[model samples]
Target chain A: MSATLVPVDEAPAPGASRTKPRLAAWIGYAGITAVLLLFAFGSPFFLTASNIATILTQASVFGIAGVGLAIVIIAGGDDVLNGGIDLSTGAVAGLAGTVTALAAAAGTPGMVAVLYGVLVATAIGVVNGLSVTLGLRPLLATLATMGVAASLELVFSQNLKIAVTGGFFEAARGSVLFGIPLVAWLMALIGAAVWWVYGKTSWGVNSYAVGQNPTAAQVAGLDPRRYRLASYVLSSALAGLAGTLLVARLSAAVPGIGTQILLDIILVAYMSMIFSRRRLVSVVGTVLAAVFVAALDNGLTLLGVASQWVGAAKGLLILLVLASVTLRGRKNR
Target chain B: MSTIETLAAPVEPSPGPVAAYSGKKRGTLQASRLVAPGTLALILIVFSVLSPVIFTVGNLFGILGQVALLALAAIGLTLVVRAGGIDLSIGVALDLGALASAWLIHDGYRAWVAVAGGLLCALAVGAVNALLIVILRIPAFLATLSVWFAGTSVQQLLTGGGAPIYLSAPLVPDGFAVIGRGYFLGIDAAIVNAVSISLVVALLLGITRYGRKLTMAGEQPSAARISGLRTNALIASAYLLCAVIAGFAGVVLAARSNGYVPGSGQAYLMDAIGAVFIGATISRYGRVSVGGTLIGVVIFGLLDNGLNLIGLSFFWQDLARGLVLLSILLAAVVLGRAKSRPATGIFALLRTTKHQALTNTAKGNRK
Candidate 1:
C-alpha cells in the first residue's frame, strides 16, 4: 500500500482552466464537424436504429475491456516493462464463455455456472500475473496463455456454439429499466467503478508510481511485483466479466469468439491512454475511443462496405491515433 | 555424469558471490528453456513411434518445409531481439513482401525481379519501422505492432482480399522448389534452407562489429548512444536485415504452400517470437544461441508433423505449443534468478530472512 494520490491535482484536471490552444481546439471542432457531415451526407444508412444499436453494443464490450487494459498499460509505463500486455483477455473471455456454456448444457445452474467461468477467468489472470512477476516477459507470457486458453476452448467444446441458460441470456440481452441496453449499462457501471478506484484509491497511486519507475518504487518501499500482479489479475477478471456477458447476451459461446479481438481492444485502449495526454489510463476516455471505433465500424457496415474494409479502416485509425499522440508528446517535450 | 557435464559446461563464469546467488535462483529458469524443446521432442518421438507415417519422407519433408520458413524468420528476428527490439510486424512484412513479389510475377516480371522486389519492399517497411522508433520516437513494441497492422492492410488491399497467388513458371518453380521441395543428396530442401540461414546468421552475429553493436544497443541503449555508435542507424540496419530475410522466407513459404491467403503467415509470428526467446534461453542456459533456435524450430516442426501423423487434432497441437512456451519462459526466469543469487553467504542469508523481517515490521508500524 502507498499514499493515495488524486490524479486531479496531477495535471490537466477535468474542468480546470482550458489548456487547449486555438489551433488544437479548431482541429478538434473540425474533426467533429467532419464526422457529422460524413454521417449526414455520406449515407442515410448511418442513421438507422439497428446500425446505431449494433455500434453501441460493440462499443460497450470493447470499451469495458479497454478500460481494464488501459489500467495495466498506465501502471506499467512506456516500455510496458516486464512485458505487461494483457493479450489473453479475449482468449480468457472466450474460454470462460465456452466453459460456462458447456456447464449450462449439462444442467448446471446459471448463477453457479457463471461463477465457475469467472473463476476460470481469474485463474488465467493469475497465471499472467505470476509469469510477469516471476520474470516472464509480458507479451510472451500473455501470448502463451492466449494459446492455452484458445486451445482449451477448442478442446472443451468443438467449434460448435453452445447456448447459454435461458434466464441468463434473456437478462443479459434485454434492455435495462431505462432505454439503455444491458450491455451499455454494464459497461457504464464498470467504467464508473474503474474511474473511482483509479482516482480515489491507494492502489491507483501504487500503479502509477510503479509504472513511472519500478526500481524507484521498490526503493521507495513499494512491492512492484505485487502491484503488477494485482493489476493483471484485476484486468483479467474484468475481461472475464466482459466475456461472460458477451456469451450471455448472444446465448452461445462460439469458437473464435476472441479471434482478432485483441487488435481493436489494444488499439482503442492505447489511443484513449494517449489522448488523455497525461499518459494516465482513463475509463471515460477508453470508452469514448471504443465508441468512436464502434461507430465507424457500424457506419461502414451499414454503408455496405465489406468486413475486410472495416478491418483496414480500423488499422488506419490506430495509426492515426498513435501518430497524433506521438507527435503531441514530442511537441510537449 | 555426462549429462551433468554437458549442462554445466556452457555455464558462464559466476560473477563472484552475486553471480553464484543469481545462478542458484535461476535453476528452474535454466531448466525451462531446454525443457520446452525437450517436451516438444518427447511428444514428437512418442507420436512418431506410434505412427509409422510420421517417419515417412514426404510427411517429414512437409514439416521441414514449415520449419524452414519459421527458422529463417526467427534467425532475422534474433538480431532485432538481441538489439532489444521485437518486430511484431515481421509476419505481416513477410505477407506483404510475398504478395508484392507474387504480384510482380503475376504481372510478368521475372522471378528474380519479383524476389528483389520483395526484398526491397521488406527493407522499405523495415526502414519505416526504424524511422518510427529511432527518429520519431516510438517504442519498438508499439511501432512494430503498428507496422503489422499497416502491412497486413496493405497486403489485403493489394490482393483485393483474395487468395494468395501461385507461381507456376517452370525453372523458377523448380529452383525455388528445390529450396523448399527438392532434396540434396537426401537432405530435404527445407532443412537445407534452414541450416544455411542458421549458419550464416550465426557467423554474422558472432564475428562482426555489427553484432557487437546489436548487443550493445540491447544491453544498454543509452551507453551505446554515448559511445557515439550511431545507435539508431545500427538499429535500423538490424530491423531492415530482419525484414529482408523475413520477406525472402515469405516467398519460399508461399511456394511451399503453392498459394497464399490472408492467414497464411499469421501463425508464423508467434512461432518465430517463441523460437527466438526460447533460443535466447539456451546459452549459459539463460542466454541466446543461434544453434539453440535451430533446435527449437526443428523440435516444433517435429512436434507438428508427428502430431498430424498421429492424427491429433489442431487443439492438441495448440496445447502443446502453449505448454512449451510457458514452461520455457518459466525455466528462463528460474535460471536467471538462480544465476543472480548465491546459494550461501552471510549477507545473502541475511538479505532473504532479515529483509522479510524488516518489511513485516515496517508494515506493522504503518498499520
Candidate 2:
C-alpha cells in the first residue's frame, strides 16, 4: 500500500520560478487586474460594490474546492504524482451534498446532516486512497468512483433535487466578516490550514517525501501510505464541506452539482502553475486562480457576453498557460 | 490444440514471464478467452432470464448501432492505449467534430465536406495533444485530460452555452444519414463501419512494422530507442490516429442523430474505456488487440441495450456500467497476476516472484 512517489508538478516547467521573466510575472497578475479594470470601466455597473461582492461570493465555492485539489497536487514535489488527481472529486461533493440535503429534508438535525455529509465525502477519499494503494490504476480508479458516485447520488436522492432549510444552511450562507458568506471565510480558513500543514508541519514534509521518493521516506521511517491516504481524505473532506455550503447557497442539492465544479477545480489547480509566481501547486495559487477564473467569468458576463463564450475563454486560457509553461521549460532545459 | 494456440497467439511478446503465462496454456484452455466470453454469456443468460419479454433478435441488431459508435472511439483509443498512452479527450473530441460538421450541414455544405470538417477538427485536437505529450513532456493522462476539459469548453462556445445543433433530412444530402443509420449488406452501417475499422486497425497493428514499433516503444521506450526507433514519432502517431478515428466516430454520431447536442458524446467515454480494458482480458498476449476490443464493445453494447430492456433507470444503468468496469478491471488484474505469477514452473521455480513481477510492470504502467 505504498504510494508511488512521482512528482506531479515535475511535468510542468520545473524551473518556472527562475526562468520566467519578471515582467511576465507582473503581466500574469496584472492581466487579471486589467481584465477586471476593463469590465469595471467598460461596464459601469461592474465597478459597483455590489457587483464586486457578487463576484467574490460566486468564487467562494470554487475557491474551497480548488484548495482541496491543490493539496493533492502539491503533495508531490520532485517526483510528483499528477495522477493523484481526483476526477471523482465533484461527484463525491455532489453525493455528500445530496445526502446532507436528504437528511435535512427527513427532519434530521443540522449537525447530524452535516456530519453525515462530511462522512460520506471522507469515505470517498478513503476509497480512492485504498484503490490507489491497493493496486488499481489511480486514473481508472477515480474514474470508476466518479461514475459510481454520480450514479449513487442519483440513487441517494432518487434522481430528484433535495431542497432543505435549516440552521446549517444559514451558517453556510451567512456573512460574518466584510459581508462575505461564511463559506468564503471557510475557504480562507481551509486554505490557511492546508498552507500551514504544507509549509510548516511534518505531514507536509512527509507528503512531499512520499511523492518524491517513497523508498527514501520509508528508509527515514515515514509511512508514505498514511500521507498518501490522508491527502485524499483531506481533499475530499474539503470538497464535501464546499458541496454542503453549495447546497445552502443554491438552497437545493442536485445529483449533478459537482459535474462542472470538478472540472473547474482541476482547471484551477492546473492554471495555478501559470498564475502563481512559483508555478508549483500551492493553496495560494489555487485560491488566486479560482478567483481569477471567477473574475474572468464575471467580467465576461458583465460585458454582456453569453456564458458559453466563457467556456471558450477557459480553453484558450489553458492553452496559453500550457504554451507559456512549455516555453519556460524549454528555455530552462 | 489449435484453439489453445489461437487463444494464446496474441499475448504481448515483449514483456511478462513467459513461463508463467505459458503455464496456463499447458491446460489446453487459455484463461483470458474463456473468462471474457464466459462473462458476456453469463450476463446475457442472467439478464435475458430476468427480462425474457424484452430480449429479441431485432433488439440485438438495434443494440449493434449503439456498439458501433462506442467501438469506433474505442478502436481509435486502442491506438494510444497500445502505445501506453491515453486519449481522455476522444469523447469530447467526437462531440467537437460532430458539432462542427453538423454546423456545416446546417449551413449549405455537402455532407462529405461537413464530415471532413469534423474529422479535421479531431485531427487538430489530436495534433495538439501530441504536441503537449511529445514536446511539453506531459504525461499522456494529464495532457489528454486537460484537452478534454478544454474540448468541452470549445463545444460550449461553438453551441453558444450548450445549445443543440440540428441537421434536418433536407438540410444535407440523402447519403448523410446513411453513414450511421443506413443498412449495408443486411447489417447496420455503423456496425459495418466498426467492423471495417477493427479489421484495418488490427491488420496494421498485427502486420505492419510501424505497429510493432509502436508496441515496442509503448512497452519500453528505452528499449525501442536503443533499437533505433523514433519513439516520440511512434507515440505521436498513436495520438494522431486516436483523434482522427474519434473524429470519424463523431461524424457517424451526427449522421445518426441528425445533429449535435452539446454533451452527447460524453456518455461513450466509460464504455470506450471499458471495451479497451476488457479487450486485454481476451487478447492473445494480454495486450490490447483491436479484435479483442471489438469483442469488448459488443459485450458492452449488449449490456447497455439489455439493461435498457430490463427497464433499469438511467442512473442505475450508469451504476451498472461503473460496477461492470470495476469488475472487468479487477478481473484483468487478478487474471493477469495469476498468469504471470507461477504457482510453480521450470524457470519459475528458480525465479523469485519479485523477478517475475517486472514482467507485468512495464506492460500496465498506465500510471
Candidate 3:
C-alpha cells in the first residue's frame, strides 16, 4: 500500500546520532519537574503523600491505556493521513467495562468476567486489524469500530450505570501495595514489562522498523502488515484491561466511561513523545507522562478548576510542546 | 443513454486504440458511478416500504432540512479533506458559532449582528488552526484536536458550565425566526441555504482558479510550491473557509433549536466525517466533491429519519448507522478491488463462466 511508504514524523533518519535525543530527554525531564514544582507551590494539598497516591490511582486506568496507545503510535505511527491511530481505544474500553460488569452481575466469576471483557475487546481489535490490512485507513476504520463499540456499550448497559461490588471489584479498588493501589502497581508492572520488550526485544525493534519505513522493513524480511495488525490487537487488549480496571475503581460501569477518558489517553500518549529519546514514543515515557498528566489534573481540581477546564489546560500544554518541537526542528534544519 | 455516456466517458481525451480500450473500461466506470445512487435508491425503497410516513410531504421536508444542516458541515469538511488536511475541530467552530450567536441574541443584540459575530468567532478558530498548521507546522489532526478540546472548554465557560441558552419566542427576533422557521418561494430557508451553499462551493471548487490551486496544493504541495503557487496561503484559506462554513451550519442549528445547546454541534462531527468519506467512493480518484457530499448527507438524513419513524430506540439507531457505514466502506473497497482484478479470492470463485469470459475479453482488449 502507498501508505506503507509514508515516513512517520518521529522516525529519525538512518545514522542519526544520539546527542540530540539526550538533549531532548533532558528538556522533557526539566519540563516535568517545572510542572511538578509549580503544582507543589500552587497548592499545599498537592505535595501531600495521600494526594500523590491519589494521583497515581487516578492515573492507573488511563495510564495503562496510554501504554497501549503509545505502542500503536510508536509501531504503526501517529500521522493522521498515512499512519494510524486507534480511535476505538476509549470506546473499546467502555464496551469492555460494560461487558465485564454485566457478566459479573449475571453471577459470573470475577476472572471469567474479566476474560469476557478483554476477549470481546480483542475480537474488535481483530476486526480493526482486518480492516486496516484490507486497505482501509486506520483512522476511519477505528472510527467505525468506535461508533459500533460505543453503541454496544449503550445497548448492553441500557444507557445506565451498572454498579459492581464485592470480590474483585472491591479488591481492585481497596488493596494497596506499599501505600499505592494494586491497580497502580499493575500499571507500573505493565509499563515496566512493555518498556523492557520495546527497548530490548527484536519484536519491538521490528515494529519500530515497520513504523519508520514499512517498505524497508519488508525488505528486511519483516511482515509489516502483521506487525501493524499485532500492534492494534495489543492496543485494544490493553484498552480492555484498562476499562475493567476503571470499572473496578469506579465500582460501576458508566455508559460512556471509556470515551470520557479518551482525551486523556491521547494527551498522555502524545505527551510521552516529548520524553522519549529522539521523540519516539516509548513505554517508560508514556508511564511518566501519565503520572505527570494526572498530577496536573489533580492539582487543578484541588485549585477549584473544573475537569473540563483541566482538559483545556492539557490541550494547551500539548500545543506548546508541538510548537516547541517544530521550532527546534526548524533550527536544526 | 446520455447520462450513461457521460458517466462512462474517460476523464481525458484519448486517441485511436486507447479510445477503444477506454470504451471497454467504461463499463466498470459506469458501474462505479452508479454505486452511490443505486444504494440511495435501494435505501429509499426499503425505508418507504418500512414506513409509509417516509413519503409524506411533511416528513420529506423534515428530511430535507436535516440533510441541509448536515450538508453544510460535510461540505466544509470536504473542502479541508480536499486540501490534504483533516479538521477535527470543525465541531468546535460550529459550537462556538452557535454559542456566540445565541449568546449575542440573548444579550439583546440584533439577530443579524449576532449571526455575524458567530461566524467571526468560527473564523477566528480557523485562523488559529491556520497559524498552528501553516506556521508552527503541526499536523492538522493534532492541531485541530487541541483546538477542539480547548474550544469545548470555551463553550462551557461561555454557557456557564454547559447550560443551554434558550431563546423564547417573544425574544426571538424576526430575522432569527425567518432563518430557522421561515420559508422562501415554497421552500424551507434551510434547504435554500443548503442548495445555494452547495452551488457556490461547487463553483468555487470546480470553476475557480483559486480552488484549482488549492486542490493542487493539497495533492502536491512541493510541486505546487515549486510552480510558484502560494500553497501556504491557499491552505490557510481552505481552513478559514472550512471554519466559516461549519460556523454557518452551527448558526442554522442554533436557530432550529431556538437555543445554544453546549456541544450540540458536536453531534454532526462524526456524521459529517462519515458522509465525506462515503462520498469519496463516488469519485474516480476518491477526491471529495460538493455534489457527492450532498448525496451522502441525504442518505444519512434518510436513514436517521427512517430509523426514528421505524420506532427503533436511540441505541439501535446508532448501531445501525455504524454498521451501515462500515458496510458501505467495506463494499466500496471490495468492489473497487474486484473491478481492478476480477480474478481475486472469493470474487473469482463467485464469477460465472460467462462473466469470466467477458472479463478476460475486456482484459485482452486493454492489453
Best by lDDT: 3
DockQ of each: 0.24, 0.18, 0.22
**Candidate 1, superposed: residue stretches over 4 Å from native:** A1-37, A45-50, A81-83, A163-167, A303-306, B1-63, B167-173, B285-287, B342-367
Candidate 3 collision pairs: none
Q: State the local distance difference test value for candidate 3.
A: 0.78
Considering only chain B, report the TM-score of model 1.
0.78
lDDT tens digits, residues B1-367, model 1? Answer: 1111121111111123323433433234444345556765776678767987876778877787668888988888887877767788888767766777767766766667777887888888889888887776676788888777777767777777766676664635454445456778787776787788788888887888878878776644655766777777888888888888888887776556655566566678888877876676655423455877777777777867776766789887877887777887676566545644543211221122222222222222221
Clash totals in order: 28, 12, 0
Candidate 3 off by > 4 Å: A1-16, A20-25, B1-34, B341-367
Over A1-333, each residue of candidate 3 has an lDDT whose tens digit, in order, gives 122222222223323424334355467788879988888888999988789888998899888999998887767655655566888899999999999999999999888999999999999888887777666667777888888999999989989999997788898888888888788899999999988776677787777766654544555578867877888898899999999998998899999877678888988888887774455567887888889888988888888888668768987988977776655444433
The i-RMS of every model, in angstroms, reads: 17.1, 14.9, 15.9
- Which candidate number would show the highest DockQ if scored against the true structure? 1
Who is ahead in lDDT, 1 or 2?
A: 2
lDDT for model 2, on a 0 to 1 scale? 0.72
lDDT by residue for model 2 over A1-333, one digit each (tens)? Answer: 112321222233334334545555555677667777888888888867777676676777788877777776654331122235777788888988998999899999887897899899999888877665544555566677888888889988888888889777876666657766566677778778887877677677667555543434455577756776677788888888878878888889976877878878877877777765444566777787877888888889878987666776776677667666556544433
What docking grade applies to model 1? Answer: acceptable
Preferred candidate (DockQ higher): 1 or 3: 1
Native contacts retained, all candidates in order: 0.28, 0.24, 0.31
